[model samples]
Target: MSPLPLHAVAIGDGLTDPATQVLTKPQQAFAFGLVDEKQLAQAQALAQEAHDLALAQRYADAADKRSAMEDLVPLGARNLPEA
Candidate 1:
């Protein structure tokens, strides 16, 4: 018995170049799978770094706003108008 022509099989530690072939749909799929895996990993790492930076900036901004509000509180003339 032999493997079917269109059957999907896993390559085990093979030295196949994923982006060098375009013969069948399965080959294209395999290439895209490799590219997508790499792209997704990179995107995930970038997202995590962006999220950390955003969180740090937000915290710093909140602290600055709090300090500004505290300084204004001592003036007593910046109170809200009566409603």
Candidate 2:
């Protein structure tokens, strides 16, 4: 028989959860010396754009994986007959 499948898993448990995801906006603002109004606005905008792009990419990837699994389920089911 073939060896058991070893599925890859994320390192951290809840740390990767959306609720716990880190917000680098404030930190970026502080790093960029956001004491001035203009600078603060610019930094906040940049951070927001970056965060949105990252979230979009994550969702796209998840959808792609889910679509791929549609094919895998039938094959897996075929491997196991009724109990």
Candidate 3:
């Protein structure tokens, strides 16, 4: 028998409905210095691809693309560890 398909858990729960959530933009990171436009463009492409994959119900692939896009950007100061 085929195994059951696995899906990602919804973004929020209970009080927050996933359907009501609106994504104005994809993930973005703030850098301490100048950021590369080429990397930004690449990340944007990945974001669009991820959105398309999610719409096609390829959740895992979409998440992978999102992770790749995230890796292109540096973490913001707020997310950095203290020295």
Candidate 4:
């Protein structure tokens, strides 16, 4: 099948500690793939790089970065999963 248009796509991936709360998990992944203009492979590579860098830090630091990124997204765009 042909690839979907970038505007038609919504992709997300993240790592979480086993004890992380369920509702918060999606929010963490949201920072990676949402609102990207890059091709999927490039986006995935960047996300992998971010994930690897995050993994090198303490969990709390990574979580803080995710939260900060999410905050930068406008409210309308932040509601993707709800739609």
Estimate the TM-score of every prediction: 0.28, 0.33, 0.53, 0.33
**Candidate 3 regions with alpha-carbon error over 4 angstroms:** 1-34, 76-83
Q: Write the per-residue lDDT of candidate 2 for residues 1-83, one digit (tens) a residue.
A: 99988898656333353311323333433444433465445544544544555577765544343333222223333122111
Point out where model 2 deviates above 4 Å: 1-24, 27-34, 58-83
Model 2 lDDT at residue 77: 31
Q: What does each candidate score in C-alpha RMSD?
A: 25.6, 17.9, 10.5, 14.2
lDDT of 3 by residue, 22-60 (tens): 121232332333236676677667767777777788878
RMSD of 4: 14.2
After the best TM-score superposition of candidate 3, give how far the Cα of residue 70 lies from its true spot, in angstroms. Answer: 0.1
Tens-digit lDDT track for model 1 on 52-78?
444566545443433343232224432
Which candidate should be chosen as best, given TM-score against the real structure?
A: 3
Clashes of each: 0, 0, 0, 0
Where does candidate 2 clash, by residue pair?
none
**Clash number for candidate 4:** 0
Give the C-alpha miss distance for residue 30 in model 2, angstroms. 4.8
Q: Model 1 — which ten-residue stretch has the worst lDDT?
A: 18-27
**Model 4 poorest ten-residue lDDT run:** 14-23
